[model samples]
Target chain A: MKVKPLADRVLIEPNPAEEKTAGGLFIPDTAKEKPLAGKVIAVGPGTSDVKMEVKVGDQVLYGKYAGTEITIDGKDLLIMKQGDILAII
Target chain B: MKVKPLADRVLIEPNPAEEKTAGGLFIPDTAKEKPLAGKVIAVGPGTSDVKMEVKVGDQVLYGKYAGTEITIDGKDLLIMKQGDILAII
Candidate 1:
């Protein structure tokens, strides 16, 4: 299924942490830390004034406090406005 | 101290869960669940094209997927654009 956001909002699929540390890994589903990385699956039209710099295939980093979580097609995804995006990778 | 967001962005201080119920309680700092409620402390100028409907002092409900987290004056704040706000309370 395709998810689209309106006016600067973005649809992101969080990238799960790739590694576990020796101290014993902290799982986001279990850890106090919020997840901060994801892949952009869809993006809204620019914020009306500021043009967005990310595209659908971009990998980005967002603030830990940014974005709203939603489940689409049973897949967890985040819906955040472009301005909340901190950086693109 | 105060934190101000830029251009349609909002600064919010999360309202911690008011109650915990269960066979046991789940702490956000421990649970896989994300925190979603907060009070608006500061708001940016509305998006250039769309005037924001929210203002500082509004109690809001955001998508569980929105906003970025930042610490200012030793307090945690979420930074998000107005569009990420799901509803105003």
Candidate 2:
């Protein structure tokens, strides 16, 4: 099923937490930091005052605990407001 | 010292954590959630591509983990990029 967001909301697929460091040493789950980046899957139309700046397929960084998590058709997703997004990278 | 942010940056004074519940029960620090709102103390002249919409003295809500924390003159503050801010309230 496809997910659509209401005004000023966005749907994202978060990047996985780092499993290893740059040196390729494996890192334990408990030592991993929360992922703060994701790919935009869908975007809302936006309210008149807050125009949408991100689009589908855009990679973005956000607050570590910004969005609500959900699973749809076995895919993990995050639904957040446009304001929760930090930057399009 | 006064703070002046670089392009698209903002300085904020976060709202205090909730210390008591509506029922007047004291809540411990561990149980308190991070403050997601603040008062803008300064704003940067935005980059040409991303115009700043928030102004000094505006009340805003931001992603809970959006900024870097610092203490100046014994006052705790947060410094964040414009992208980290969610909305003016």
Candidate 3:
């Protein structure tokens, strides 16, 4: 079955972490948590106080530990609030 | 100068911690951090994506370490997003 995120949450498929990359990538360090890059797999219907900014197939940046990890269809993924996303790349 | 919270932020004047009391108080322990009670002193205009839910003079509950501590006009206060608030008391 396909997983669907609830209000203000988004389902993301993280890109494999690059090993010592050096160019064309913007890595922002906001706190102790590391930054990660990913692709949006699904998005929730945002609440009245929030709006969904990222759509499916959008490349995004988020905190490494920003979302909850879940397994769907034998694939690992993350479900987080839209606020957890740092930016759409 | 009086402080004004920006975006979805709210300014709160916290209630003093009770000296180990036990009635009419709903204490929610979501994590290691303790819950706190406070009065909403000011609220932001809210972003286009977020609508302000709490209003000035509203008594609210929130996590203890949820916001930044600031000293204004010789008085200490907290500034945090409306999302940090758990409920209105």
* Candidate No. with top DockQ: 1
lDDT of 3 by residue, A16-81 (tens): 756212122434422233346678999999999786767899876566568999999988899999
Q: Write the per-residue lDDT of candidate 2 for residues A14-88, one digit (tens) a residue.
A: 877652121233344333232266789999988765567778998765666788998999999999997676555
lDDT of 3 by residue, B1-89 (tens): 45555557788888865621323465665545556788998887677967899999999888756765444454556777898999998
Worst 10 residues of 3 chain A by lDDT: A19-28
i-RMS for every candidate: 7.3, 10.3, 11.6
Give the TM-score (vs. native) of candidate 3. 0.46
Task: Give me the runs in candidate 2 sitting further than 4 Å from their true place.
Answer: A19-35, B1-89
In model 3 chain B, the worst 10-residue window by lDDT is B17-26
Choose 1 or 3, whichever is better by lDDT.
3
lDDT at position B6, candidate 2: 47
Give candidate 1 regions above 4 Å deviation. Answer: A19-35, B1-48, B51-89
Error of 3 at A13 (Å): 0.3
lDDT of 3 at B37: 85
Deviation in angstroms for A78 in model 1? 0.9
User: lDDT score of model 1?
Assistant: 0.68
Candidate 2 true-interface contact recovery? 0.00
